[model samples]
Target: MIRVLLFADLQEKAGIREIEISAEKLTINGIREHIMELYPQLTAIKTAMPAVNEEYAEGEQVVKAGDIVAFIPPVSGG
Candidate 1:
């Protein structure tokens, strides 16, 4: 089980801030796919950036069970 923190549209669309997926080692790409599966409106999640343990991560980043993953969309504020 992995802990995922949703943000912005993701939270609004899914009505949940965190989710636990059933996987031993879930990759960044795999997370996107799972998110899209859970929230069909978030298909664009594949283009967003994800972080593992508060560090910038890539599409192929490996997320093991018990790891904390944060989903961060592009930031823009003045």
Candidate 2:
């Protein structure tokens, strides 16, 4: 299973901070799509950045079982 970590507003919108998906290795885009399907309320999630094993991941980055994937939403400060 692939472990997913949600941060900031993404976590609030989804009402959860973590999730696990049972599937073969999935690309960053694929994981984004899966999240959207599971939590449509997180509309802003599409713009979130995906990370694998604590490093930023690219669109084609592959996330495999036991990997820690995180979705970091945009944040701003004054």
Candidate 3:
């Protein structure tokens, strides 16, 4: 399973901080698409930054089973 974490607005919008996807492997973009499918309310996910195992990952980065993927939305404060 691939563990997915959502933060800030994404988390609030999805009403959950984590999600588990049963898949052997998927690209970061694939993960985003899956999350959107699971939680259509999280439309912002399309622009969220993806991190794998705590490091920023590209859209094509492969994520295997047991990998941790986190989607962080842009933040702004003044």
Candidate 4:
């Protein structure tokens, strides 16, 4: 299982900060697609950035079972 971290308003919107999913060997893009399919409310994440192991990751980066995947939405502040 891979641990997925949701940040900012996504956490509140999803009603959870994190979740575990079975996505061994799937790329970040694949995970994003899966999330969109499962949770239509989080469709905003379609344009969000993905991170793995605390580092910014590419869409094609494959995720391992023990990896932590985080969907980071664009932040705004002034």
Candidate achieving the largest TM-score: 3
Candidate 2 backbone overlaps, count: 0
Error of 2 at 66 (Å): 0.9
**Poorest 10 consecutive residues by lDDT, candidate 1:** 41-50
lDDT of 1 by residue, 2-54 (tens): 99998897777788999999899978998888888888987547766789999
What overall lDDT goes with each candidate model?
0.86, 0.90, 0.95, 0.88
Tell me the TM-score of model 4: 0.91
Report the Cα lDDT for candidate 3.
0.95
For 43-72, candidate 4 gives per-residue lDDT tens digits of 778778899999999999999999999998
- Best-to-worst order by TM-score is 3, 2, 4, 1
Per-candidate clashes, comma-separated: 0, 0, 0, 0
Clashing pairs in 2: none
Choose 1 or 3, whichever is better by TM-score: 3
User: Against the true structure, what is each candidate's TM-score?
Assistant: 0.89, 0.94, 0.96, 0.91
Instruction: For residues 3-68, write the lDDT of model 2, one tens digit per residue.
Output: 999999999988999989998799988988998999989887788888899999897998889899
Overall local distance difference test of candidate 2:
0.90
Cα deviation of 48 in candidate 4 (Å)? Answer: 1.5
Q: Highest lDDT: give the candidate number.
A: 3
Off by over 4 Å in 4: none
